[model samples]
Target: MINGRDPRIDFFRGLALIFIFWDHVPGNPFAQLTVRNYGFSDAAEIFVFLAGYAAVLAYGRIALRDGFVVACVRILRRAWVLYVVHIFLLTLLMGIVFVANNHVETRDMIQEMGLSYFVRNPQQALADELLLRFKPNLTDPLPLYILLLLALPLILPWMLRRTEYVVGLSVALYLMVPLFGWNLSAYEGGVWYFNPVAWQLLFVLGGACAIRGQRPSAPQPRPLKQQPLFIVCATYVVISGLITLSWKWPGLHEMLIPKAISDLLYPISKTDLSPARLLHFLALAYCAAKLLPTGQAWLNNWPAQQTCRMGRYSLEVFCLSVLLAPLADMANALAGDTWPMQVFTALLGLGLMMLMASGLELNKRLGTPGRVVAV
Candidate 1:
């Protein structure tokens, strides 16, 4: 029986955090094993979807018990916290990249990481950063998340009362993006990398799913394996796997995927959250849900539990990952991106993240004063 917190959410969120760390380190060999290589979607989808799910689980409960006003205060307060973290993270990342460049004579690090504007025009860049405009690469997701969380005050009430209508509105906004070229403006000129307009659909859907799961009186949804739609999802996952594997084996890929289909899906849009990526993540999520049902005892095993600890402290772990990325890059550049070095860098970075999570867990266990544990 599903009761209290679900371990699966933390498990997957932690796993996504790990993948995000691996993917951020450009030359890491382990990155190829991440979900992005085998599927249309990657850690970003998992992160955002789980964010939405967790938001509902956390703020939704507060709304139910304490009233909408209290929920709004809590949600908006959390958003403010995320905003502050983003600013600090951006400052720290710039510092890291700057120092790394000077030490290694890799001046292009700033430009390569998309922080050149700060170097070229500090005043304007500082202004843009304050306005949440000038986000460097690997930092885009936070602003998008901030916007979504800020909107939760309005979103959560509707989600609890008119779930379909709220989701329908989110989808309508998503469809309008492609039709009307809608997007939130970014630093200097371009649109947000993870366009919130389109991505909100996934976020809202995740929240809806969490709401459904929480209602004990409502009939539980059928298991994915029992559903006819599972066959289609599984088939899509298999085909995507084959297509991605083509990167390793070009000849086999050519034989597996026709040129016409490849051309049609080429440049699968991450900025717009393309349909292929969205559906692929949904399929992967369905399979995960089925395979790891609720309250599975094995989830409490040491490694899984440790990963869950990381998920429990996702914000801290994610901030650490962002900061560690440039350092990892510097290490890779210095040590040479040999297979051994890449593997070592990836392992070491992951170990540090685990260690940080462990420290936070330790804080909670010790009931340290002023240490707020996230739900």
Candidate 2:
């Protein structure tokens, strides 16, 4: 059933998880290079973009083999798994806090499970870990992914059943991003750091792209030089240049740039799908795609395919990494600002994650669990 999985998607997803781990670890030698820390190039956009691509690729297969209904069911099932993982992580983090400080007040814990805590304090350090508030803590991505997964079924149906409607809807939604900012605060428990309601359009757009490739609107074949990859790269360059220019040239600000144009470069906060950020991410993705070797020889070689293994079991790896992140943070914190100790601790944390990933890969192949794989 899982025989035809693409190595490219799996490999990149593994890379994304690796970047995510480095980014989330409180203070590590690699944090600065991680997309999370960099202002210009954050991995959030890359992760979301690739997620869109992977969703379409996976759903394309399901839609063809199992029909739309089955695809929808599978998507929902996956989302449910994500939610279960989130709850487990939350409980574990709360336990960590309780164990670390036995005197942690009940009122604080109660506040964490509800909406009031987020409202009372935004960047409160205690709140970030205890409440699992989005953005303020790196652990927030899972909750956001869960929200996105909820919207996947809704968007995927139209994408598979009637693509033109999806196109018009996506365009309308993209345009409206400039007209009205999303009401992030309205989310019941706490807002998803990356609001998928707005981001769904992108993912669905990718699905549509994949669908088109599998079954074209017309039997026309363009030259190899005019491929989608090339177009994507060109578009990325133009968009990125425009964004950079907007930043460099102060005089351009006062010009009659459309509200949509202005919004692209300078995104409003709390919204995840800003056109500027989206384009920036796309550019980076294009570059990565180009650089990554697409050969299948190494992928097919059983013993030499560890990267594929890592990619194939990304969900488990991601869970382990997230679970261990706080401990990594605590270690870094204890190591203090000492450069040598911090470096050593960071390396130790990375080494542990690598071992976990390797062991998980081995266990998965052998059909036995030897030791826990903590990302």
lDDT of 1 by residue, 1-375 (tens): 113577799999999999999999987888988999998899999999999999988888888888999999999899999999999999899999999988665446888899888888999989999988899989988998999998889888889888899988998999988799789898778888999999999899999888877767644488556777777888899888777778788888788778998888877899999988999999988877766668859786888988998999999999999999889888878876577877888999999999999999887876977666677
lDDT of each: 0.88, 0.60
The best candidate in terms of lDDT: 1
Best by TM-score: 1
Superposition TM-score, candidate 2 onto the true structure = 0.70
After TM-score superposition, the amount by which residue 287's alpha carbon in candidate 2 deviates from its true location, in angstroms, is 3.5
Give the C-alpha lDDT of model 2: 0.60
Clashing pairs in 2: none
lDDT of 2 at 261: 60
Clash pairs detected, candidate 1: none
Each prediction's TM-score versus the true structure: 0.93, 0.70
lDDT of 2 by residue, 127-239 (tens): 45333344334555676666666777777766667888987887777666557755354223555566655676666665565565455244327743477876776566665
Q: Could you tell me the lDDT of residue 208 within candidate 1?
A: 89
